[model samples]
Target chain A: AQSVTQLDSHVSVSEGTPVLLRCNYSSSYSPSLFWYVQHPNKGLQLLLKYTSAATLVKGINGFEAEFKKSETSFHLTKPSAHMSDAAEYFCVVSDRVLTGGGNKLTFGTGTQLKVEL
Target chain B: GAGVSQTPSNKVTEKGKYVELRCDPISGHTALYWYRQSLGQGPEFLIYFQGTGAADDSGLPNDRFFAVRPEGSVSTLKIQRTERGDSAVYLCASTPGGSRTQYTDTQYFGPGTRLTVL
Candidate 1:
């Protein structure tokens, strides 16, 4: 079984300050991890993803996450938080590879990032 | 290019009624997914379709909840004897599949349909 746990339910940070949202996982196989953002009344947008190739993944809007196997974590980080970064963030994990073209995702509960000015 | 699209952005219905939600995935995308998000929670996978066939339907909550992708590009999630527990924002996502890498199947989500079962 594979599962993802986000450490924080809500995180508040001032604009221009650093941001960190923590996530840990339990997967039998090496996992495919991703971060997604959702604004109020909007759809989810992929922030970044970690496949087998990369450990440190950079995403749009200056957000990034490191896939650390030792820590059992893939924590999203941004050097400078923007007001626009305020939204609900989700950390996701995929259970298995596609026998042919498998691309399934299981999501964590989510963290609400509140950026204050 | 246009992203995935779902119809009837909001639907309010009485309990015990039947409702259908629709999705039109990205052009040329071979894989589509349906998920439901309740208040204050992450989206839960309902089902996923590969091409015109359902590759997985295990996530569906109960027999009353069903989905179909008959022609491959479009899908409909049907709920029979709708329950109040079914009220939530139903999301649709699609990926251009053919590989296992997340890049090959990075899901593009639609705005979602807000279904209210009263």
Candidate 2:
């Protein structure tokens, strides 16, 4: 089974400070990882994805995640946090489909980011 | 260019009633997925549809939960004998499946339908 675990349920950071959200995964095969953000009552927005091609993946809104296969980790990071960055973040792993189509995503218990001024 | 869209933005139903949630995927997307999200947890996959057929339904909780994508563009999730535990946000997403030329298989999500079973 492929699964992802978000280390923090909530993270608070002041504006202009650095931000980091940690995630760990367990997978039987090489995994495709992703980070998605959700605002209140809104749809999920894809921030970034790691597809084995790149160890360091850059995403929308200045967010990035580095996939470390040795550690089974894909941690999201941002150098400077903005107030608008306050949202819930989810770490997802793709479980391979046996029928040779798109894989189903396994999501982590989200992390709520609170950006303060 | 429209993103995925789900109908009945909010639904309030009584226990033991039946309900149907609809999803209209983005134009030309070949894959559609349904998920259920609780108050604080991430979305849980319920089913996956490729074209007009369900490629995977293993995530469905029980026999009362059923879904169909007859036309390959729109999908409907039907739940029978709904319980209070089924009260949650039902989300739909779509992606370009099995496209080798595409760099990423990212799924685009809809705003989601909030279901409340009282």
Give the candidate number with the greatest TM-score: 2
TM-score of 2: 0.97
Show pairs that collide, candidate 1.
Answer: A98-A102
Per-residue alpha-carbon lDDT of candidate 2 for residues B1-118, written as tens digits (9 for 90 to 100): 7999999999999999999999999999988999999998999999998899998898999999999999999999999999999999999999888675332488999999999999
Off by over 4 Å in 2: A98-100, B100-104
lDDT of 2 at B10: 98
Candidate 2 accuracy as lDDT: 0.92
Q: Kindly list the per-residue Cα lDDT of model 1 for residues B81-114, writing each as its tens digit.
A: 9999999999999988766463336899999999
Best candidate per DockQ, number?
A: 2
CA deviation > 4 Å runs, candidate 1: A98-100, B100-104
What is the lDDT for A89 in model 2? Answer: 99
Q: Best by lDDT, which number?
A: 2
Q: Could you give candidate 1's per-residue lDDT for residues A1-117 as a string of tens digits?
A: 878999999999999999999999999987889999999989999999888787899999999999999999999999999999999999999866543455667889999999998
